[model samples]
Target: MKKAFKYRIYPNKAQQALLQVTFGCCRFVYNKTLDIRKKAYETDKTKLSKFDLIKKITPLKEEFPWLRDVPHVCLPQAVYNMDAAYQNFFKSGKGYPKFKSKHRSRKSCKFPSSHCAVLQDTSHLKLSKLGLVKYKKDREFAGVLRHIVVTQESDGRYYASCLVETGADAPEPQPVEASTTVGIDLGLKDFIVTSDGRKISNPRFYATIDRRLACLQKHEAKKTKGSKRRARIRLKINKLYVKKRNLIKNYIYYVAKTLLRESQTLVMEDLNIVGMVKNHSLAKSIQNICWGELRRVLEYKSQWSGHNLIFIDRWAPSTKTCSHCGFHNSTLTLSDRSWVCPGCGTHHDRDINAALNIKRMGLASLLPAVSGFDGRGEVGYGLDEASICTV
Candidate 1:
């Protein structure tokens, strides 16, 4: 198993300067290699592998002597990272490699284990070029260090994320049962509504700070660009953004941890968040809810905890269909929060109904294949049988 531990690092002025140079060098290497690979493929349909790109770094250093000033190991790692991006592009048919911008792109660089180490005191970290830098180690971690990535955030805070191999086998997933299973419907009104009838209210972290952030931005806009005042205001705005993100992250972690601790098989909708955010009216709210981030956290944590995480088809009519009587309510509008099922006279809460349907859909996927099991049945197609099997 592999785990990552992140800690804030305080680098001296000289170390910070070197870190900035290392970040620039790494970005330059990545963008230059990407350009080379793109042109090679476009002109002659040639492919450049990781090693091939690494071989070019030597000549690149000869051409640009400043590249030699940063740690040598980081340069090759940059090529490796670019190669990975290209490979992912080819595999996914999306996310083509793009040039990293000095201002917009993330300021980060990777260092191999040979060039990085955590000191015995655990309060200091040693890197090849940058000597021992002090860091706040919040928790103890035991593992063989694989690598470390140093990142400088928008607010000028620096952190180190250390990846380590724990050398432990992951627990096997437990069997799914109705009593132990749960379904989650993520929403803006509420953070989540579970099949078990639990509703966790959305904290609306962004909304809480929206007015203040807007005020800060307005003040920042009044300042002249490239001026000290503008820079100070910009830093303040960035810090606020960081605070909002941290709040949301911590809340989601708590929610995910609670769910995984209680449920054996967790089911959720595979929402198309990219498409959902297209609605101008809901874009800001949707982004603030961080549905995608919550799902991502649930996925990895479930795997780590040996729990089953299930995502039903994105097209599944969890919202429109009646969970009680298996009736398809095609007329159910987005504004309809509560609806009475015409088929069975059952009253349903929209989110809870959707959650139940999601749970049923997930359990249906685990059913043994049979002649009538088409796998595309409606939300409550075989609810009775599933309930029986789960019991």
Candidate 2:
């Protein structure tokens, strides 16, 4: 397995200057190589190979002497990244590569395994060009170092992401008890409502900072471009944004961890977040909720922790169906928080009822394809018993 561990690093003034140059050189190489690839494909209907772009580096450095000031390894890494971006675009049908801006783009550079080394227990990293820089190593990993990416965020904080190849393979999930199964209903009002009638209140992380963020943006807009005042305000805005992101990230991690710990089998609605965000009135609220990110966190964590994570169909009428008597209420609107089921005559809490329905559906889907089999059996054909933990 491959994993990345990131840590905050504090570089001296001279190192910062060198890093800035390295960032610029890397960005320049990426953009230049992208341009070369585009022109090559357009003219000859052929893509520029990584080796072809790499061969140009020697001449490029000789022509532009300043490129020699940064680490020689960075240029090749940039070209490799460009090749990867192009490959990803072709493979995934993603958008075409775009040129990176020095001012607006992310400042980052990758150092290959041989180019960088970490000092054990010294809390320092040594690079080919950049000398030993102090970093806060919260935890250490036992693995072969693959690569390191040094990035400067908008908040003016520098971070080092160390990628390592851990020799351990993923563990297989154990069988789960039916009593520990849970279903979660995500919402703007309450972050998560469980099938067991537990409601986790939504902590609007962005809402808390929205006013200050808006004020900063408003002031930043009024400031003249290229002025020091604009730069100062921009930094302030970025710091706030980073804070907001951190808060939400920490909250989501806590929620996911807690849920996974409590539930052996977890089920959630497969929400269409992109389509949901199209509603202008609820866009801000939906964005702040960050349902997609939470789901993503749950997905990977579940695999590692040996938990079952299931996602029900988005179009399922979880809200309309009664958990008690399986009554379908067609006229149930979004505004109706609580409703009495016509067929069941049971009052249902909208979110909780939906959660229950989702749980039932997920468990049903896990039922054996052919009857007379012992235990839960295989979760339908094409899905093996061992792979049911995967989302």
Candidate 3:
């Protein structure tokens, strides 16, 4: 298993200058290599191989001697990173490789520990050409260090992300407590409603800062380009963004932690957030919920903590069905918050009913395989199919 731990680092003025040089050189190499590859592919149908790119480095250094000022290890790593990016794009159908900008791109350099990257002690990191830098060691990790990525955030803070290779595979999923199963329905009105009837309010962190953010952005726009005032406003906007992100992250972690602690088996609806965000009316509120981030956090944490996380299909009629009677309400509109079931005369709260339906569907899916419920929905054990909620 591999994990990364990031900590704040304080580099001296000389080291900062050296780091800036490295950042620039690495960015230059990445952009140049990408441009060369794209042009060659377009003009001559030639894919510039990594080896071919490496072969040009000598001539490149001779033409541009300033590249020699940074650590020798960083230049080749830049080529490798670019190659990896292209490989990822081709393999995953991600966006095409794009040029990096010094002002817009993240300032980062990765150094493999085998090549002049080391930890002198718990509180210090040493890199080639750059002396031992001081960092806060608030937590300890047990593993062999593989690589370290030093990043300069937009807010002018430095961080070092140490990747460690733990000599073990990730723990396998364990059997969950059947009594602790839960289903979650995510929404904007309430952040999440559970099948068990618990609701967590949406914090709306971004909404809280929207007015100030708009003011800062407008102020930044009025300032002349390349002026000190524009730079100052940009820094202020970046800081506010950083603060907002941190707040959301902290709240997400807390919520995920609490949910995982309570439920051993958790189920959530598979939402099409990218499609949903296209609606101009609800886009801001939808983004403010941060459902994607919440889902991501729950997924990894569930795996690490031996909990089961399941996603029901996005097309499931959770919101339009009566959970009590399994009756699908075709005429139910988004505006209807509460409704009465025609089939069973049961009243349902919109979000809570949706959560209950999700839970029922999740249990149905899991139970059929585990409890010998056959294709015809018949249980071998004389028990009602609905009674065995095994998710």
Candidate 4:
């Protein structure tokens, strides 16, 4: 398995200058090569491979001598990065690769294993051109180093993310049973509501900083552009954003860890988050809650821990369906927090009922071949026929 460990690095003035030059060189190479490939394809329908682009780096250095100032390896890595982006576009029908701007794009460069190393003392990192940069090693990591990506954030902080091969096989997935399985519904009101009656309150990290963030932005807008004062205001705004992101990341990790620790089989609705965010009134709240980030964390963590993570169909009517008697409430509105099933007279808390329905549907989907249930109906695997028709 491959995992990445990140550490904050403190570099001297000279090293910082060198790092900035390297970032510019890498960006230049990437953009130049992308332009070359794009023009080739357009003019002659010719396709240029990564190696072809890498071979051009030597000629580029001869033409533009400043490129030789950075480590030779960094240029090729840029080509590789561009190649990966193109490959993803071709394979997944993703957006076409666009030119990276110095001001708008992320400033970063990658170094292969041969060009980067962690010192034995664990307090410093060694790069080909930037040697012995000091870093805060918060924890020890054991694995074969694959590569390191050094990045400079908008807040002017430097971080190095080291990718390593752990060499440990993933654990075997446990059997999915009724008692061990759980269904979760993610919402803005509560971060998560599980079928087992657990509600993890939404922290609303962004809300806590909204006023300060707005004030900073307002001040930034007033400052003269290209002035030191404007830069200072911009930095402050970036720092505020960084702080908010970190808070949300930590909280999401905690929520995912807590849920995975209890359940072996975890199920959730395949929410159309992009569509949901289109609602102007809820967009801010939706983004701040980060439903997508929580789902992403749960996915990878569940795989590492041998837990089954299942996502039910997006259109499965989990919200309006009654978990008790499988009664479908067609008239339920978004404002109705709790509703009583007309058929079974069972009262339901909206979110919890949705979670329970999601759980049942997921379990039913897993056993469709044996249960004779198509997994599309409101009534799930074990529901009695009489109860299913009660409505």
Candidate 5:
């Protein structure tokens, strides 16, 4: 098994400057290569591969001879990544590659320069360009380093992620006795309301910290673009975003672990959250809950613990399907939070009913009552077009 451990690397001022220069150079090369490919298609049908592009890099070496000694892997990795981008485009059949937007800054670069130091046992980790950087977090890792990826964040944080091969320490679990299976209904009002009368409210960390973030953004806007003041403001905002993300990730891990520890089987309604976020009123709240990420954690955890994870179909009528009596009320709408079941005298909480129906569907899936989704094949992406069949 491979595990990743992240630590804050404390690079000195000089090291930070050098690292930034290297990062800037890498970004320049990546953008240049994309331009080259774009021009190649525009000029002629001839294509340019990494090998063809390496010759052009020689001119770059004359301009920055220091880069020539930087190491082979670092530069080639960028070219290979560009190739991979085209590969994925064809695989997904999601139309032609669109030019990356300035506002939509979602990409990153890697440096595999041999000089890029591995996480070693010295007082600090030394990189070729960055020099020795200290850390407070435990680097006493117990795994062999398999691969390393050095990422330059858009906000200018340098992170070295190591893929390490570690021996599994999983305990041979005792056979679980009779335990309850559960279905989860993720919502905006409540973070999650389960079939078993359990409901957790939305923490809304982003909403809580919105004022601070807005202030930071305003401060950033006031600063001259590319000035030191702008960089400093951007860095502060990046840390806040990172902090919120970490908190959310930790909370999700806790919930998923707790659920896995107690349950023998976990059932969830297959929701295309990407699609659900289209409604302007609920989009912000939905993004805050990060329901999709929560489900992902539950999936891997349940799989590791030898428990079943079932994803009821999107069209399963979980919300409208009555648990007390097997009645499918097709007329149930979003506005009705409470319902009087015509089939049986039962008061059903909207979320709870959905959860129970999910549980029933999960149970039914285990049997061969209907064509059970094998969780294989292409899954949903985009608005409600989900990739969660195997969820």
Candidate 6:
């Protein structure tokens, strides 16, 4: 069982500068290599290979002498990045890699850390050429690290992820209390509505912090791009984002723990959030819910705890179907929070109804029940009475 734990790092000021420089150089190299590969593949048919990229490193170093002091593996990593890009491009994953912006750029660097390597808890990690440096010690996990990723976010926070090998097999579970099944509905009005009748309110966190964020953005926009003042504002904006992120992460952890304590099986709607966000009206609200983040935490925590996390499809109409009477509303509107089923004449509290149906739908899909009963959890095009209740 291999697992990875990522922890935020608080490096000293000097370390921060070194990281920024290294990140910039790596980003430049990655883009350059990708560009070269793109042109080559377009002009000729040969695929860019990682080994070939390493062969070119010597000539590259001669042309860019400053790179000699940097980590040797970085060049190869850049090539690997291009190979990955080509694979993705071929698979229609995303648009080609474009020139990175100074402020709105992606920021991450990877260094090879193999299994059986010596590392310390709360001690320095040695990168090639870069000397061992102090880092903030955080909780360690139950695995031998196979890789480490150092990332600097737009907000200027650093993180180190240790990809570890726990073992080839899963460990026996510790004793726990008897558990129950839960169906969850993630939304804007409520963070989540569970089949067990849990209504976790959507904390309008960004709504609370939006003004300050807007102010910071305005200040940042006033400064010249790449100027020290712009950098300062950039840092300020990043810190605000970090704070919100931490708050959301903590809340999610707390929620997952509470739910796992009671439930063995988690039934949830597999929402197309990225697609949902495409609607201009719901974009901000969608980002605030961080539904995707919550689901990821739920999945990993369930895996760690030996619980089943079932994702229902987004096509089943968990919302439009009446949980009590099994009646379907063919034309339920978004504004119709409360609705009555024409066939069954049953009144529904939209969200609660959705939660109940989800619970029913999930059970139907995942469990074997008597006739006329289906699973309580479902996710699909709520666009057509395909709605999951807001509960």
Candidate with top TM-score is 4
Off by over 4 Å in 5: 42-44, 47-66, 69-72, 93-120, 126-131, 152-157, 167-180, 216-233, 273-277, 282-289, 303-307, 368-391
Model 3, which residues run further than 4 Å from truth?
Answer: 116-122, 206-208, 276-289, 369-391
The C-alpha TM-scores of every prediction are 0.91, 0.89, 0.89, 0.92, 0.77, 0.83
Off by over 4 Å in 2: 276-289, 369-391
Instruction: Score residue 200 of candidate 1 by CA lDDT.
Output: 92
Over the stretch 91-161, how does candidate 4's per-residue lDDT look in tens digits?
98878998899998999999999999987486999999889999998988898999999999988999999
Candidate 3's C-alpha lDDT?
Answer: 0.80
lDDT of each residue in 1-391, candidate 3, tens digit only: 7778898999999999999999999999988888888899999899889989977777889999998999878888899999999999989887788889989999999888876454546588888889788988888788899889899998999999999887877777765444577889985468899988998887666776767889999999999999999999999889888888788788889999999998878988776766665757644544545788889889878877778897888677779877776667998988888899897788888999888777666766675443322322111223334433432
TM-score of 1: 0.91
Judge candidate 5 at residue 82 and give its lDDT: 62
Candidate 5 Cα RMSD after full superposition onto the native fold (Å): 6.7
Best-to-worst lDDT order:
4, 1, 2, 3, 6, 5
Instruction: Give the deviation of candidate 4 from the true structure as CA RMSD.
Output: 3.8
lDDT of 6 by residue, 113-215 (tens): 7311324664666666555656565765665667777788766668777778887665444322112666777644677887667788765666656689889
lDDT of 6: 0.68
266, model 4: CA deviation in Å? 0.7
Stretch of 10 with least lDDT, candidate 5: 375-384
State the weakest 10-residue window (summed lDDT) of model 1.
382-391
Cα lDDT computed for each candidate against the true fold: 0.83, 0.82, 0.80, 0.84, 0.64, 0.68
User: 1-391, model 1: which lDDT tens digit per residue?
Assistant: 9999999999999999999999999999999998998889899999888898899999999999999999898999999888888889889786788899999999999999999998847589999889899999788788899999999999899999999898887889887776687888875467789988899987665785878999999999899999999999999999998888888899889988899888888988777766765757644455445778888898888878899988887667778777767888899988888899998888999999889888777777776532233333344354543332221
Better of 1 and 3 by lDDT: 1
